[model samples]
Structures are given as C-alpha cells and as structure tokens.
Target: MAKKRKVDNLLALAVLSTIVERPMHRYEIAQTLCERGKDRDMAIKWGSLYTVVQNMAKAGFLEVVGSERDGARPERVIYRITDAGRVEMADWTRELLTTPEPEHHRFVAGLSILAVLPPAEVIELLGARLDALGRILEVARRELGDLTGTLPRLFLVESEFGLAMLEAEAAWTRSLRDELIEGSFDGLAQWRDWHDRGMRPSEVTASIERGVAEN
Candidate 1:
C-alpha cells in the first residue's frame, strides 16, 4: 500500500531527483527536469511547480539556501534537498520499485465498455490503434537504438521498459483482433447478436447483468 505523502505530487520527486546533484533555483529545476525528460516519465503540471516547491519546504523536505539574481530579473531562491528529503526520495523510490499499483488506463476503460460498439467496428478501431502503435514503436526503437552505445544502460533502461510495455500491449491487442477476425472470441456471438437485433446499449447491459446474476 502507498503511504500518504506531504507533497503527494510526482513533480516533487522529479525536483528532489534533480536537485540531489546540487542546490538549484526553481527555474533551473524546471529546466533540468525538462532537459532530462522527467515530464515523459511522470505527469507534471508546470504551473504547480512553485506551490510544490513551497510545500516541500514547509514539509522540511527542502530548504532555501540562498537567492540568486540574474541581472534585472527577479531573485530566485536556491533550494537544497534536506536530509529528510533524501530519506523520503529514497523511500518513495523503493516503494515504487517493489510495489504493484493499479493504474486505470484509458484503453482499459474503453475495453471495459467495449460492448457499446459492434465487433466489426471494434476490430477496425483496433487495427487503427495497432498501426499507430507500430509507428510509435518504430520511432522509439530508432531513437533508443541511436542512444544505446552512446549512453550507459542505466540511463536508457526507462526507455527500454517503456518499449517493452508498448510491445506487450501491441501483442495483446493483435491477439484479440485476430480472435475477433477469426470468430474465435468467446463472447463474440452474443455481442454480434445484440447489435444484429438492434438492442439498445442499456438493454444489452441489463441483459448482461441478469445473466451474471443468474450465473
């Protein structure tokens, strides 16, 4: 189980990871995070960065060491990760690495209500999705291939993991599409019958509910 955090936003983790190298002002932190592609790894709201940093300080995870002025620009306070922050970062990382969490993905949500669409239409949509996934995998593979020998494996492991997940999803989607196309999907007959009979979605759902209750 995940424990409650003082700064629950993932941007705080990105901030801690970046500033662990050295104390940085907010601008520098945001810049470094962008440069390192932290936004891709986590959902980061740029507008909420200031508040996150302030809350981290209040939580004793960070401390303002000094202020820096760049010419006529406003002063930026440099923040350093406190000992508590380091502990928090390490603990959070450990929890993430070791624990399994349920994430509700958009694709899963659509699949849960898939009976809303006819099987033929669903197959067509899946084909389109597979094509898009193939293109994305191609580009990502090319980029990662270029970076492979140039950078150490440690840095590229995240990209590797991401590619693995995409590949898995693509493979599973392909299997499902093949099953539907071959008329081998277990519930494909009932699904088609509902659409053939021009049954409303709510009626189909109620029928399915009764079937489940009887079962």
Candidate 2:
C-alpha cells in the first residue's frame, strides 16, 4: 500500500482556515501566521508550513487560483480553498472544540509527570508567560475599545468575556510564580535524573504519540 499521507492535521486546519478567510499566496500566509502567533510567541516553521500547504493542495483541499509577481522574485502561487476544503475546515473546527481535552502532556500533565523542575525555573517561566499574556490582554482590550461603537453587542460581550479569562489566567500565573519563588524549590536536578532513568522506551514513545495527538 502507498504510505499513508501524514501531515500535521491541526496545522493543516489552521492553514485552510486562513485561506478560507481570503485567498493568499504562501508568503502572505506565513506573514499572517506570524502576526497571529505573536501573542503566543510562536511562528509557524516555514518549511513545515509550506509542506503542509503543498500536501493540502495535493489532497484537493486547495486549488491554485492564480499567480502573482512580486519584483525580482519568481511568481508566487496564490491559493483558494475548494468546497471540500470548506467542509473539512468546518468539520475540523467543530471536532476540535467538541473533543475532550487530551490527557497527555497537557500543561497539567507536564507538571504532574516532571514535577522535578526547579521551583525557581518554573516561576521564571510562568512569570515570562504571564508577561506575554498581559501584553496580549492589553492589545485585546485596546482592540475591543476601538470596536466599541462599531461592533454588535454580542461580539462586544464575547470579547469582554475573552479578556476577562485572559486576565484571570495572568493573575493565576502571577500568584503561582510568586509562591514558587518564595518557596525556593530545587527540584530540577532530581526531576531530570528521574525523567532520564524512570521512563522506558515504550513510555517515551507513548508520550510523544500523546503530544502529537493533542496537537
């Protein structure tokens, strides 16, 4: 049998969603993803992102609608979603939200399994994340403010709720970071040793598979 086609399914879904919003060239898609990911401190790996795009094109989820020339570079291929792509995107979105939260390597899972991380290091990481989250919450607040007179009431309410949730998370992270810093936990060395010795090959593979599945 032909090797099963394996692509990052979530990444494919994200790419298709972007294309459905508006047909765009590959570079434009990369730029859009970078912009969207700024709050999360993430940028899609270009090679991997393009690979997913190409695979989707081959799978008939996307069609090359046209080409665009930009200065000295070769003509860039612009893509549009086909009907199948729309159906797939809708299905993925619904399934993603409705699916139970996966149990593996979830933030909680990492904390539970690798409880050996130095308290200080964990605090530092959480503090940094909280700072990033605060910045994102601020931007969201500003965007909502700008939409005050322009958006519908339902959208406004939804936006407010999102902002509240972000703020709550930031507060929680801050509290946890403070506790860790004050506690002077020194578990990292022990945790690393445990992780290196305790986990078997099968367990490690299972962890990796769970990570992939969760993503």
Candidate with the greatest TM-score versus the true structure = 1
80-199 per-residue lDDT for model 2 (tens digits): 999988887887667656766543434566555434454445667787788789789989989878878886765467567778978887887777677566654454444344466766
Q: Model 2: runs farther than 4 Å from truth? A: 1-7, 33-42, 103-110, 113-165, 170-215
User: What would you estimate as the lDDT of candidate 1?
Assistant: 0.93
> Per-residue lDDT of 28-144 in model 1, one digit per residue for the tens?
998888776677777666568999999999999999999989999999999999999999999999988998989989999999989999999999999999999999999889988
* TM-score quality measure for candidate 1: 0.95
> How many collisions between residues are there in candidate 1?
0
Query: Which candidate gets the maximum lDDT versus the true structure?
Result: 1
- The pairs that clash in candidate 1 are none
| Superposed Cα deviation of residue 107, candidate 2 (Å) | 5.2
Minimum summed lDDT over a 10-residue window in model 2 is located at 1-10
